[model samples]
Target: MHEVLIVGGGTVGLSAAVFLAHHGVRSLVVEREPGPQVHPRATGVGSRTMEILREMGLADAVNAVAVDMKGISLGKVTVETLAGADFTTMSPSAQVYRDPDFTPARMRGTCPQNRLDGVLLGAARERGATVSYGTELVSFEQDDDGVTAVLAGAGGTRTVRARYLVAADGVRGAVRDALGIGLSGPGVLGPGINNVLFRADLRHVIGETRFAVCSVTTPEAPGTIVTIDGEKEWVFHTNADPAHARDVIRAAVGDPGLEVEIVSVLPWRVRAQIADRFSAGRVFLVGDAAHAVPPLGAFGMNTGVADAHNLAWKLAYVLRGEAGPALLSTYDEERRPVGALAMEQALLRLADPRLHWDNDPAMAAERARAGVVNAPVVQLGYRYGQAVQDLPSAEDVALDLDGSVGSRVPHMWVADGVSSLDLVESRFTVLAGAEDTAWASAGARLIDGWPYGPLLVRPDGFVAWRGTTPDDLPGVLSRLLHTA
Candidate 1:
């Protein structure tokens, strides 16, 4: 029996396996597809998600192949046509995440879903996680002990047992539907759009204003030209027919003279939804299974990756017998709200008039004055919430760690040329002050010379508890982590 069984080999499931492997937990990732798709579906990876990858020790491998789209200079320019009059440029996406001030270690990267899957699969396998392709989860039955599931693959049908199961089966989410879980909020956010993948020498046309998304406002072929390689390989998102993709590409690029070769076309719907429940007993939903946000601003995948990270540590400790089973319930408590919040924010961003070539000036001005920009804050600055209904908050005071108990610990430097984040990924730790405060709790590291006093930082980098002396450590762990 594997410690964790993950359904679907997309970014979320792969992430779950890698994260579990970081804690020496073995996972089996069963993917329905024969292999990874070479589709440039989700092109954006947020700064926060990058931080989590670094902790899992997959950052360098991922960053090696992940393209950073920051060099693309042109913002969203509202143009009448690909070759016609130009309108005001839309607000540029925030690059603050790349700056050292915002994050000490990680930066955002633009890698296609398929490429990301390969990277994650490599990392998981390298760390001893089994990823089986062309394997489908036929059915799973869960009891108070564990989950017994039947899997169908090329070889034949087989049975496996796992302590926990993660459902990352995507928006349609067969597992979620089978479990009779419901979704809340808007089902379909907008009309169905087609993504046409093609190749053309658009470098000359793009010039210095290389953009990730360029809006073509002409009635001939209204769509956004998305750069896949920050170059010629692109995806045209429009309402036009697939057969007319070549012409649509030429029209959007404003270059009838250039030859465009159509690669692949995908038609998909945009949805804004959050699952009513993230988990039912031992089966938990992650990524698109838990929430479905529009593809714009790259919120969907990043939020899903974060969901996997939040659940990975808790699941690992509980399965390892280091923490009580009560810790598993906190997974839903912590991540469900995040899914809802990301969905809501993604909807607002999708509705942002600035993203469109033509917009109501009055509404834009009001939103601008209201400081309605949440891309950075929503992506990175979000803190964790109360895990359980009666989780204590008395001595759970916020310290130097982001000024909140449930919030992530702020990134700082370590004495060994590593990051403070690098120090806490292995297990729960208590960093004491330089002045020698007695904070010796079992399984907690007592380090001196911290700028602040004693702080109980969790393996996930969130402040679990804090105190001045050793006496406060044990009770805090019992309450926050529910350690046995």
Candidate 2:
């Protein structure tokens, strides 16, 4: 029997496998499709996701494959056509330019979904994860001990048993339906969008000036053009039919003579909803299976990656006998709220992409009073467990890290060319001041500050406790891990 079985081999599921492998836990990822999708789905990867990738030792690899669209892809630009005169650009909010000290990780980059998936799949396999494509989960049943699942594929049907099961099969997957889970929140947000992938050379027309997203408002075939490589590879999103794909591309580019080759057209819908629960019995849901949010802020994939990161370590500890089984329940308790919050934020962005960046003092003040925060806060400022109770009534627009419980530890330079974040490993670490000699024997990562107390940092890099005395350290650990 496998220790863990993951359904769906998209970015989120593959990320879960990689994270689990980083913790020395192996998993089997079953994807229905024979291979990764060629067309790009998501183009933006946030800072938090990059940090997690750094922790998994794939940061360099991802950077090599990702395109740096930082300054080039600033905001949305509306143009008459690719080679038109009239242009309207929406200035991005000041919140987009975050403080350099916000994190020790590198800046976020843009990589087509297929490229990112390849990176994750390579890393997961290298780290001892088994990924089987062309496989489908026919049925599954979970009990207290484990889960028994029947999977079908080209080979035939096979029964596999796993200690735990994760559903990453997407928004309309069968596992969630089999579990009888229901969705909550506003359903569909917008009209059906057709992703039209094509090859074209617009370099001569736009030259060095390139916008991240170009909204072509051509009368015949209005659509949005997203740069995949900032060159020939591009994706045009519209509600046009696939039969007239060439016409749509030509009209959007405003160049009837421009040679265009349509590659693929995929239809998708924008949705804002989350599962009523994230888990059932020993089975859990991750990514689109748990929450389906609009892609306005590119929060859907990022949130799913975060869900995998949050649950991977806890599952590792429990499987290793270091934490109690009850600790697993915290996966839902912690991730559900974050999923809901991401859904809410996605909807807000859908309605107004620059809602959090309102310049008016009165509007900003009202938004602040209502606890409206920007992307950084949603990405890095979120907390888990008992730490939620300590959140302020209104969150700041910047990333919040004060060594607080349930929050990620603040990034600080620990040694030459090494960040405090680099010191976090696959075990519970005590971040103590140099003066605190007690934790020295405990193999703590001693750093400045907290001379009056020590911080217990979990394997996932969240602060589990902050206290002055080490006398009750074991008790605190017991409570947090539910090992007692």
Candidate 3:
């Protein structure tokens, strides 16, 4: 029997497998598709996701295959097209938005989804995760002991028992339906979009403006042009029909002479919704299976990877007898609110500038405060405070981490090219000022002398608890371990 059985092998499923294996827990990832999709939508990988991958020793491998779009103009020209635009007309950064105070070790990047899937699929197997493509989960039953899943593949149908299951099966996947889960929130954010994958040489028309996303505001084919390879491969996401998508691309680019070949046509919906519950007994929903966010902020897979990172360590501790089963409860509690908060942000972005959307006052006010888009704050600042308890800090603004219990530990530099985050990579770590000896004197591998005052850090790099007074240290540690 497998310890963890993951259904759906997209970025979410494969990433869940990788994170689980990084914690020394083996997992099996099953995908319904025969192989990688021809065109995947997500392009931007936030810095925080890059940080988590780095901790798993995957930064080099993933970065090796990624396109560094940082500090490059994302959109261009008279307004949106990539023609006759000056350098100043270009945008700030390509992928990771740089933050002065809390910048991580990695910058954001863009990689083709199919190539990224290939990277993750290879990396997961290297880390001892079994990834089976062309496999489908027919049905599953869960009791107190474990979950028995019936999976279908080319060979035959087989029953596999697993202690836990993660549903990365996407928004409309069968596992969520089989579990009888329902979504809550505004259903679809906008009209259905058609992703028209095509190969075209745009060097002549692109000119000096470089971008991963170029908005073509032409009345005929008004949509966004996503650069998949920064070269030949591109995806035009528009409302136009596939039969006329090629013509739309030509209109958007303003170059009818450019050679374009439509590779695949995929219909997608922009949705902002969260599952009523993130879990059912031993089964948990990760990625789109739990929440559906519009692509405006590129929070789709990034949020799901955050879900996997938060859950993997907790599952590891429970399975290793280091923590109680109660630890698993934190997954749903912590992730659901973050998921909802992210959905709100996505909705806000999608709701903006569109006369068709109904703008709630609160959302409008928040949007006004967050004037122009600042991607870093949205990516690095969200907390899973709900994991132990749902505590969204109303007074807390984005982009600042002030030693809060449910927030990411403030970053700092250490000697030997180590980061403050490196301390909590594999297990629970106690972080204190460099001079503080109380934790060390107690014979714990005290990560002596850090910025924060006696913070209990979880394996996932979030602060579990903190107390400067140092009273009831053991009790506080015990409580946090049990609760988290």
Candidate 4:
């Protein structure tokens, strides 16, 4: 039996497999599609997601092909006066906020979905994950010991058992449905249309601008214009009826529009939602299967990627006997709120019509300050709250150097030219203050019986329990490793 079976081979599934394999756990991926469908969906990869990819050793590949989005441009086009509309370009300002220390590592990169999937699939394969394409999980049954899944594919049908199952099967997940978990929020909003995967020769019209440009059309038709895959590709997202979407796009671009080639037109609706629960028995949900948000801040895919990373390490610990089953409960507790917050932010942006620029001097300054300047906090400054803890007061929890537990583990320049993230591979890090040498030693003894290596790591990079001390290590470790 496979150690774990991941349903779907998209970004979340592939990322989970890669992380599990890197930590010496075997996993299998079952995808309905034969290969990556580089749809124009989810084009931006956030910085934290890139850091996780770097840990998986796939960052270089992603960075090599990604388009660096320097900035954004907003223009106003009224149906009554479309001829002489003013367009304002907004660039990144010098005043930095939100994790300025990680500035060198904090930038969003864009790659087509296909290219992103290719890099992840390659990483998963290299880490010894068995990826079976065009395979559908027909059904599954779970027990205390393991899970049995019936899969249907080109060859026919087969039954495979696994220790655990993770459903990354997008929005319409059979596993989630089978578990009787109904979607628990407002349904998708107005019928929106996205003209994805299309090609156009508008290099001369839009010029060398690489980042996304938002064009505010008349109230009759509002949409976003973007370039994808180094081509003049436009994703026209309209709030109007899908039937009238084409006409709206034609009107926005005007006649003699630089040779527009229509490719695939995908109709979508915005939904802000999360599953009732993240786990039931041995089954767990991740990615779009667990929660979905409007695409305003590009949080949908980024949050899913974070879910995979957070759960991978916990699963590795439990499977390796390094931690007890109680550790698994932290998965939903830590990640569910994050998904909720992201959804709230996306909904707020969508409802705020002022986000669409009006080109007024005051409006432009407000948009620049709110949209561009304060974006990093929404993108990265989220912190874990009561979801992951049972403490009565926040002071009980040890804060990172940055005083934010939800903030990413601060990236430090460790020795050997490697990052603090680079140093945290295949082990649980225990970062303690210099005064806590005794606490560090106490932690090592608790991990002696555990399966994985015990890293009695310090707040800095000094090892407090590398066979140097033996005073009350077990008690300290137990306290540090205890869960609510």
Candidate 5:
């Protein structure tokens, strides 16, 4: 039996497969599609997600093809009348206006969904995870020891056994349904349409700015026009009747004579949802299979990637017998609340009309002021309090000034010119202030008798524990090693 079985081969599933393989665990991935499909979905990869990808050895490659967005423009609309709106009223955008921290590494990059899938698939293959494409999961039965899956693949129907199963299947998860888990929260909230692909000339039609421009066609129809790969693409969310939405879009461009080719039209409903629970027996859920958020803050894919990171190390520990099965329980506790928080933020952003307006001088000034105070960090700075329950309190836990988790670790530059994220590669790390021989001895003892490698690290670059320490090491290790 394989050590782990992952359903779906999208961002989350591939990420998990790569992490598991890095930890010396064998995994199998079942994908319904023959290959990754290009969807006009989330293209902006935030700094935090980039940090995670850097650990997977893909930062440079992903950066090479990404379109950098320098800033964003906001506007407002009345029914059938587009007008200049102000952004200064929105706290999130206002923060960006003040600090204006736009470094190359920290800046956001836009990589189309297809390109992202390609990069992840290649990473998964290099890590030695077995990926079966065009495979369908019929059902799965899990017991105390393992899970047996019935799948239909190129060779036809077959049964495969695995120690654990992870469902990364997008929204409609066959595994979750088979396990009788219902998705909690509002399933969908109206229709949104996005059209993407290549076009010859868009610069002449729109101004040359590295910002995502928002135009309000009417109070009911709000649209965002973004430049991707030198082409102009449109994402329109409208309250108007679906039948007339396209007509409204055609008129807004104001040039029937302009030559524009439509590549793909994607119409989907926004969803704010989470699973009642993340696990049942030996089966667990991750990615869209567990939670789905409205694509407002670009949290959906990033959250899924974080889920993979959280679960991978824990599973590796349990399989190797370093930690008890109880450690697995922390996964749900940590990631579920993160998903809920992201969903709440996304819905809040979508509901705020002032966020989309940039034309009003008063509103624009307000947005600029708010941007200085509140930024995109709220979605990026989430932490796992549940995982680090034993962590000593230095200060009372409170949201950061930007409204994010205070205890959440900050991503800084790599100390020795290496990426700061490189420290987390393939093992548990304990970050202390400086090198401590006592902590090292404790860590070594814990891992020597145990199964997996345990690292005692510091907030800075000091190795507190190489693997051995004595004073209350187990208690420290237990608290630090818990996975999100």
Candidate 6:
């Protein structure tokens, strides 16, 4: 029997395998498609996602190929044409990612989903994960002990048993439907949009003004142009027919004479919906399977990656006999709210992009009233209410990781190049303030001026507890893990 059986080979499932393997857990990833798609989708990878990649030692590999958007505004700009003079930045001061001190890891990296999938798949395999393509989960049944899943592939139909099953099978996948999971919030937010992928020499048109997203507002060609390579390859998202792709491309480029070749066109719907339940029995949903957010804030895949990271460590601990089975329940409790919050924020961005950078008191109040937050807050500032429900205040703002329970630990340099985040690994870690006999005897790693005093960090780099007494560590773990 496999330790885990992942139902999809997209970014989320691949990330789950990598994270699980990082903790010495083995998983099998099965995908219906033969391989990764050859197109640009989800070009943004946030700092939090990069931190998880850094923990797996894949930061250099990703940064090596990723396009650095440093100094470039994540806020979208409106232009009459790519070569036109009328260019307006919608959010002038919305640079939440501009601060380098937010994280010691890579701030943000832009890589096409196709390329990112290849990187993750390579790392997952290298770290002892089995990836089988042209195969898919046909059906699954779970009992108290384990899950039995039937898989179909080119070879034939085969049945496999796994201790746990993960469904990363996408929004339209059958796993969630078969499990009878319902979604909440708005289903479809906008009209069907066609992503026209084409090749054109836009170096002269773009010139020195490179942008992540440019809204061409020309009536003749109303669409959004996204830079895939900031060179020849680009994607034009438009409501026009696929037959008019070339015309739209020419109008948006403002260069009728430029040679343009249409590569592929994908039609997708902008949706904002989250599953009512993230897990059922031994099966858990991750990525699009759990929620579908609009592509406004690039939170779809990043949220899924966070879900996989949050679940992987708990599964490892349970399998290692360190934590009880109840620890698995926290996966849905911790990640569901985060996913819902990301979806809400993405919907807000879809309604108004200016909400991303508008952090004034009035705007903050509006956002708070709407039950939404800005990009940085959605990415990193979120607190797990289920983990820290007993605390008076559990929420932490962006870059304010003050060792609160259910919040990510603060990132500070402890060595010449190492960060305080490096102290966390595959197991529960304790970062003690001083070399006290009580702390040392209780297996606390002493560090000077740790700020949190006696801190207990979970396997996934989230704070489990922060208190002055060292003896409370065991009790905290028992309560948090339900391992009495």
TM-score of each: 0.88, 0.93, 0.89, 0.79, 0.77, 0.93
Task: Report the C-alpha lDDT of model 1 over 165-260, residue by residue, as the tens digit.
Answer: 999999998899989999998899668899888888765765545555667887788898776776678888899889888887787777777799
Clashing pairs in 6: none
Each model's lDDT: 0.74, 0.81, 0.75, 0.64, 0.61, 0.81
Model 3, 76-147: lDDT tens digits are: 223344443344544343233344446455643577777777778888999999888899999999999899
Positional deviation of residue 112's Cα in model 3 after best superposition, in angstroms: 2.7
lDDT of 2 by residue, 164-188 (tens): 9999999897888889999999888
**Which ranges of candidate 4 are over 4 A from the true structure?**
71-100, 103-108, 216-221, 239-250, 255-257, 353-375, 386-407, 414-417, 432-473, 479-484
Candidate 5, overall lDDT?
A: 0.61
lDDT-wise, the better of 3 and 5 is: 3
Q: Tell me the TM-score of model 1.
A: 0.88
Write candidate 4's Cα lDDT for 1-484 as tens digits: 9999999999889988988887788899999988676665767677667767777777778877766554432222223212223233343222111224552254334666667888888888988999999999999999999999999999999999999999999887889999998777675876655554456664554455444444546554566655464445656665555455555655555533445556766667677788988888888899999999887767899889888877887788779876777767867887888787677667756765454323234554554444321234444555555332232222211232242333454455554556554554546455433444464544422322222133354221223233224454555445434532
Query: Candidate 4: which pairs clash?
Result: 383-406, 432-459, 441-473, 442-472, 442-473, 443-477
lDDT of 5 by residue, 92-160 (tens): 232122212211144344676667777888878888898999998988888889999999988899999
* Candidate 3 Cα misplacement greater than 4 A, ranges: 75-101, 353-374, 386-399, 443-449, 468-473
Runs in model 2 with CA error above 4 Å? 85-99, 356-363, 366-371, 385-399, 449-453
lDDT of 1: 0.74
Give lDDT for model 4: 0.64
* Model 2 RMSD, rounded to 1 decimal: 2.6
> Which pairs of residues collide in model 3?
334-386, 334-387, 432-450, 433-449, 434-449
CA lDDT, candidate 6, residue 389: 26
Q: Answer with 1 or 6, whichever has the higher TM-score.
A: 6
Q: Which 10-residue window of candidate 1 scores lowest in summed lDDT?
A: 388-397
